[model samples]
Target: MSELNFIVTLFIAVLGPLLAIGYLKPILLVVLDSLCVEPLPGKIGAHFWVRSACVLAVAGALVLALSFGEFDGSLMQALRRALWLAAAGSFVSIAFITSRVWAPVQRRLNAQLNGGRG
Candidate 1:
């Protein structure tokens, strides 16, 4: 592909997943809250926050390690890849958390909507 096309394609590829993941964050928060409730006792929110932080930290480290390569490309390419990795990590974690949070509610909603009268 042409350089401009490649850049646009990369941007879209990076952003699409990031946006999808971003949208899922609140759902994951709900899930984390629900799961960490009684089983987690008084520190539920803290626990979830810590877990998310840890995930981000790990992702950052991994991205840094993977991105360590030759200095051949333009600075823009490097910056784009860095941003993409950050977005990828954020979105993936959010999606994970939201999906977990959504599972129980999804089941209940499905049941109720299907005429369970719940």
Candidate 2:
């Protein structure tokens, strides 16, 4: 890739997953509250922040891995797979939270739409 293209790609790769995660964070909190789901141990405070940072770093590392092409040794290979693991966790968490959050609204809308039906 050209310099400009690589730069743009790197920026998007780093920002894209983060933007999605940031957008979902608040909604997840609300859903967790409404459902009264208990958070895991050590998931609050600094630990939570560290996990979020890991997600961002994994994304950036993945982008770097792909951009550079080819790796020598098992460590880079492991890091590349870690990117997939982190990305899966991030996106899957969002999906699960969104569904929980959406279910109530969908039920309400369906009730409203069918209100006049026999």
Candidate 3:
């Protein structure tokens, strides 16, 4: 393939899907809000972490699948790749969740120590 073709293909296959997946949650939330659905609660609530992890994992698999072009590869290989992607995505999600959970608590503690300063 020519250099230009390869670059375009790479961007479309990898970057496009990733960008779409990254925006999926926010987009859905906006749509739901537009429909007058009940406002969602904070992420610290029950099952929020698990749900986020699943979404991220599935998004990761889908994003990875966009670049899958080998017709002769074994099913096991594909499954392994998908599983790895899911695991990595879940880890990253958990890290974000942990920081999110900690940040508010840290801020509250700091405020108390600082004599109720905002």
Candidate 4:
């Protein structure tokens, strides 16, 4: 591949997943929320953690499964790459979920810490 093409491919490979995760996270949150029989009590509660864990597990499995078929490297190298991708995906997933779900709680805490300043 030409230099430009390689650069473009690299950019997409890195940013594409991040963008897709950001876009899909809200929908995932909605689906997970709908699975709950009763509305969760607080902004950050047990159900919130459960949903986050579920998302991480699903994302990790997907990363591993997808990476497994793509790598032509040795078994150890492939496993390492897959694990790294899973870790990155889990971090992104958690960051997305926390930023969305904990926004209210964070704002409240900030206001309290700032002595009710806006």
Give the number of the best model, judged by lDDT: 1
User: What range of 10 consecutive residues in model 1 has the weakest lDDT sum?
Assistant: 62-71
Task: List TM-score per model, in order.
Answer: 0.49, 0.41, 0.43, 0.47
Answer with 3 or 4, whichever has the higher TM-score.
Answer: 4
Which pairs in model 3 have colliding backbones? none
Instruction: List pairs with backbone clashes in candidate 1.
Output: 28-97, 28-98, 31-101
- Screening candidate 2 with a backbone cut-off below 3 angstroms (N, C-alpha, C), the clashing residue pairs are none
1 versus 2: better lDDT goes to? 1
Off by over 4 Å in 4: 1-38, 42-45, 60-70, 110-118
- Candidate 4 local accuracy as lDDT? 0.53
lDDT of 4 by residue, 1-118 (tens): 1344333333334454545556655655564454434556433344475555555645554654464432455555544554555556656665666676566667667878899564
lDDT by residue for model 2 (13-88), tens: 4554666666656655554344433454333533454345447544554555455523343544444544554465
lDDT of 3 by residue, 2-116 (tens): 3443333333344433443455445434432333323444433323444554465455544554455222455545445544554455455546645655675676678788985
Report residue 64 deviation for candidate 1 (angstroms).
7.2
Distance (Å) between predicted and true CA of 46, model 4? 2.9
Q: What overall lDDT goes with each candidate model?
A: 0.53, 0.51, 0.47, 0.53
Better of 1 and 4 by lDDT: 1
lDDT of 4 at 70: 29
TM-score computed on alpha carbons, candidate 3? 0.43
